[model samples]
Target: MSDGEELTLADEIVARARIHAREVIDESELAVDLGALEWDVSARARRRAGLCRWHADREVATIVLARRAYERYDWPDFAGIVRHELVHAWEFQQFGESGHGDRFRERAAALEAPRYCEAFARPRYVLRCLAADCDWRAKRHRASKPVKSPDQYRCGGCGGSYEVEHVASGRTWTTASGYGGAKSALGEEW
Candidate 1:
C-alpha cells in the first residue's frame, strides 16, 4: 500500500478512537491523535489486541493495536477493541484513574463497553507431568519459589512428579526468586 493508503487507515483509527474517548468524557478541547496507536505484532501472544498508554505530562495517550491479532477479527470486533482502550484513555485523561477502578467501571458502563478482554492464547507459565503416559498440564501467571521445584508436588493422575516452565509473553518478568503455589490454585491437577 502507498503512504497515502496507510495514512487513511491511521486517520480512521484516530477518528474512531476520538469518538470513543468522547463517549466517556466529552470535551471539545480533548486533543487525541493516531500518534498513540502503534502497530505491534507481539500483542497476540500477550492476549492484548489493543493497549492504551497515557502520558500525564503531555496530556496525551497512545493506543497500540496488535497488527496480527487485529487482522484476525472482524470490523466490529476490532472496533470494540478500539472502544475498550478508549475507555481506559478516558479514565486516565479525565479522572486521573488508570486501573479498572470504580470510576473506570462507571464510565465503562455508561459507554456500554465489555467488562473484560479475551485472554491470551497461552498461559504465562506451564506445568507438566514427568511421568510417561500421563498427559497432565497446568497453567498459571505467577509462581512463588517452592513451586518451581518438581519434588514438592505430584500429579494426581498417575502420581507423577511435576515440572515448571515459564513462557515469554512478549514482556519482561520482574520478580525476585522462583515460584510457589497452593494446591487449590492448581485445582485441575487433582
Candidate 2:
C-alpha cells in the first residue's frame, strides 16, 4: 500500500531483471517457472555480474545480480548480464544443473545473451610510464599480478619503468608497500 517507504536497492534490481527476462526469453519450453522465481542482488559480488542459485532439490531457484554491476555498466550491457544469468537458470530448468555447457550456449546464442558477463571492478590503481616521450598508463581495479610489483615490469610503449598511482587519494603508491598496508606517498619507506 506504500509508494516508496519500504523499497531497497535489491527491489529495483530484481524488478528490472524480471522485466528483461520476459523480454529476452520465451519460457514455454522451460520446466522452471520464470515468473515464480525469486530474485536478489549481491553486495559482495565483486568478480561477477550475475549468478543463478538453484536449491538442492532443483524445485526452487533464484537469480542474483551484482549490486555494483548496475553502477558500473550501461543499460544494454546490464541487460546482457541479466540474460547471461537467465541462461544458467534456463539450463538448470532443463537439466537440474547449470554451467557454461553446450545446451546453455545454444539458448544463449539464440536469445542474444552473452555466455559470460564482463567482470566488475572499480579502478583503484593506475600504472604510469616514465618514458621521456611516451604517455602510457593502465588502470587496474585490483592489485593483480602485474600491479604487485610494478617496478619489475616495463612499459610496452618505450620499455620504461612504472609508477603505481593510487587513484583514491591522488598519490603514488609504493609498490614495495604490498597490497594490505597503508600506501605511502612517493618517498616514504615501507
Candidate 3:
C-alpha cells in the first residue's frame, strides 16, 4: 500500500458497534453481527452521520458512515454516532421494531444514545437582493424548491426583491448582476 493508502477503519468501527450492542443487549443474548461496515464518501451531506441496515433473511447487518461528516467529528462524536446506530440495531434485533417509536426511544434512553437519527444537508442555493449597494442573502436547502420568481421575495436588509445569485454545491456563492452577468468575490454574492 502507498503511504497515503487508507487503513481498515471499517473493521474497527464494526467491532466497536458490536461491542456497543452487546453492552446494551447483554453478553448472554446473541448480538446481531455487524457483518459490513463502510465509510461511504459518496453519500450526500444531507444524510445522517451513520445508518444501520438490518438484513432479516441473512441475520446480519451493515453500518454505513458518512465519510465527510465522520472525518470532521472527534472520537467522542464518532462514538456517539456509532452508538446511535447500534441502538437502532439492538432495537431491531430484540423487538423487531423500526423508526423512532416509543420502544426505540425508551431503549435509547436506557443506553443514553443520541435521539436524532438523521442530519440536515448543507444549503445548495443562495438568493440575494438585486438592489445596487445592498447586501442581503439567504441560503436554501436543495429540496426547498425556490420560487419561480424569486424576485418577488424582498430582502430583509435593504427591503429589495431577491434574485437568484448563486447555485452550486457546498457554501460557495456567486453574484448575479444584470449589467455584468455573474461575478463572485470570495465566492460570495456580496
Best by lDDT: 2
- Output the lDDT of residue 22, model 1: 58
Clashing pairs in 1: 36-62, 36-63, 143-179, 144-179, 144-180, 145-179, 145-180, 147-179
**After TM-score superposition, what is the CA distance of residue 4 in candidate 2 from its true location, in Å?**
5.7
Q: What TM-score does structure 1 among the candidates reach? A: 0.51
lDDT of 2 by residue, 69-119 (tens): 887888899988887787787666666889887888887887678887767
- RMSD value for candidate 1: 10.4
* Residues forming the 10-long window of minimal summed lDDT in candidate 3: 170-179
State the lDDT at 103 in candidate 1. 66
Q: What are the lDDT figures for the candidates, one per model?
A: 0.57, 0.75, 0.57
Q: Give the residue spans of candidate 2 off by over 4 A.
A: 1-6, 27-32, 122-190
Model with the higher TM-score, candidate 1 or 3: 3
- Screening candidate 3 with a backbone cut-off below 3 angstroms (N, C-alpha, C), the clashing residue pairs are none
Over the stretch 1-190, how does candidate 1's per-residue lDDT look in tens digits? Answer: 4666555544555555556555534533333344443332243345567777777777676777665445577766766676667677755666555777776676556556565666535566666777789998766655544245556667657877766665552222212223333333445552
